[model samples]
Target: MILVTGATGSIGRPLVRRLRRDGTAVRALVRDEAKGRALGCEFVVGDFDDPASIVAALAGVDRLLLNGAGALPADGEQPMVRQQKTIIDAALDAGVERVVKVSVWHAAEGGRLAEGAHWEIERHLKASGLSWSILQPNGFMQNFITGQGSFTADGNLVGAYGDGAVSYIDCADIAACAATLLTGPPRDGETFLLSGPQALTHTQIAEKLSAALGRTVHYVSLTADDMAAALISQGLAPRFADDVAVLTQGLASGIAAPTTTAVRDLTGRAPRTFDEFLAAHHEALAALAWAPSR
Candidate 1:
């Protein structure tokens, strides 16, 4: 049996569905009973902070998908480091055969936010003596719809990316890759960098959004300092805001513009393009309250 953490999240939701569709035995670890039931699969109420619940969820599970929330402003060190490390240790003790982890692209030592946190967890997972594969995905296309730190209060897309393009992959494709790794032969000690089929600038992204939503959605490019100040004004911690600005500013150099074939090589199909992603989520896009940038 496979146990999926963060089953209600962008990747986990599709992963669980794909596994179930293929008639694989899967269990979801959820924090809420209602959410668990909504998944329509075997689920156990569990929280990363609650070790006993996690232990209970691991029973009879051979494969594990390790994923959870990202860094928060209130965090001193990313909580995911402690939480995921605990799960790795427990999964080892539970006799789990393999684990698949979701990590961010550009994860390295001393990096900011999710990058640094994921690096720490990746090290822990590797040393646990358990078979593992890590998926280092670039930006998610879902961010445009969910506003994952990409939109202002008035729904304008705001960043310090200048004119650099990012090869943002769809979360569904990430889920498909995870499903393949979990259900197929173990890919121990391998890390895959996943991306969309093409790179796109924020200006191009805004154009796509305008066509899809039938309204002009603007991309506001600001300098690192101005972006940090805007985040501070929005009540984010100055340190956290500054880190975000620095990270986004790094994108201006086209660091994340590269695309990868890992998605196709794993799933035997090409990753979705930005236009495809926008079309698939048209209803969600229509529901968003984006206004024209002033």
Candidate 2:
């Protein structure tokens, strides 16, 4: 059986659906029974913080997708790092054959908390003695629709990314690649960089959204400090908010700007373009009532 962690997330939900449709025996490791049941998969209730739960979740699973959430405390032990170690240990104990881990771009750079944790996990996965494939994807296109680091006021996209271009892939593309890696021939010790077909700046993204929605949209840049304060006001911790603001500055400087063909190579189709993504999510974008400037 194939097991998927973070099954309720953007990538996992679509991945589960695709796997089931393809007739794969799938089990979802979820923290909540209701969400698990809603997924229509064999459910295992487990919290990553608890090693025993991870062990329980690995029972009868042959292949695993390890997609973890992004938040981790800076001043304390990294929960995700511990969870990854626990999961790998349990998968080894259970004799699971293959594992696919989702990591972010530049995970090895060792600055961002999330990327740093993923770097450690990648190292552990390499030494775990299982057939493993690591996917290092760029930022998700869905972040724009979900109101992550920025938003639109009237018809303008506001963010700290000044003019740097990003090759952001759709989350569905990431999920598709995960499904392929799990079911295809053993890609032991392989790493794939999944990115969109084209690189685009925040201004370019705004223009695409405008074209898709048939309305003019602008990109408004903000200073890192201003962006940090804005994120903090939205309820994120001060340190995390500041870190993210700094990360945006890094992105603006073109540190995360690169296109790749891995998504198309794995999924047998071109990665979704920004225009395609905007078209697919047009309704949601239209529904958002932009908050007025404070």
Candidate 3:
């Protein structure tokens, strides 16, 4: 059986559905019983923080989809490292045969935030002696709706990109890639850099949003230091604010500027475009602060 973690997340939700459509035996590991039932699939109640629950979840499971929470505002520490490493260790003990993990683009040692944290977890997965495929995905187009990336209190798009483009990918595409890797022939230790078909600046993104919403949307550009100062002034932890600020500064030089064929090569189709993403998620984006309040 293939066990999926983070089964309620943007990528995981669609992955479960696709796998079910393909007639794959899938079990979602969820912390909440209600959320798991809402996934409309077989599920096991578990949390990465609870090792015993993970052990229970991995029962009779041969393949594991290892994904969960992401980084948070913490000083020189990454909770993701501890959490996923725990899962890896449990997967090892549970006799799981393979693991497919979701990692960040530019995942390397000494990189900041998710980059650094994912690198450490990837290393652990490799050393665990299990068949593994790693998907290093670029920015998620859903970030705009989730408010995980750049956004103002009034819901205007905000960033330090300085016109540099990012090949933002759809989370559904990422899920499709993971499903392909898990169900197809083993690609042990293979890492795929997943991206969309093209890069777009935040200005272009705002324009697309405007077109979708039938209202003028704006992109506010700020320097890295300026973003940091703004965060500090807003009472965010200073160290965490500076780390994010540094990452914002690096984006001005085009971090995810190039598109890749990993999605097509894995899923046998072109990745979805930004316009398609907006169309698929129009309702969520329409609920942003810039829109007419419910």
- C-alpha TM-score for every candidate: 0.95, 0.92, 0.94
Each candidate structure's count of clashing pairs:
0, 0, 0
The lDDT-based order of candidates, best leading, equals: 1, 3, 2
lDDT of 2 by residue, 200-238 (tens): 998888878777767777887999899988777766667
Sort every candidate by TM-score, greatest first: 1, 3, 2
> What tens-digit string does per-residue lDDT give for candidate 1 at 180-221?
999998788999999999999999988888888777779999
Cα error of candidate 2 at position 211, Å: 3.0
**Model 3 TM-score?**
0.94
Residue pairs of candidate 1 with colliding backbone atoms: none
lDDT of 3 by residue, 1-294 (tens): 999999999899999999999999999999899999998889999787788998999999999988875646435355789899999998889999889999999999978868888999999999888889999999888777764446676667777878789999999999999999999999988999999999999899989988998887799898888887776665556766777778866877898799999999999999999999999999888887364222
Report the candidate with higher TM-score, 2 versus 3.
Answer: 3
Candidate 2 global lDDT:
0.85
C-alpha lDDT (0 to 100) for residue 93 of candidate 2: 94
Worst 10 residues of 1 by lDDT: 285-294
User: lDDT values of the candidates?
Assistant: 0.89, 0.85, 0.86
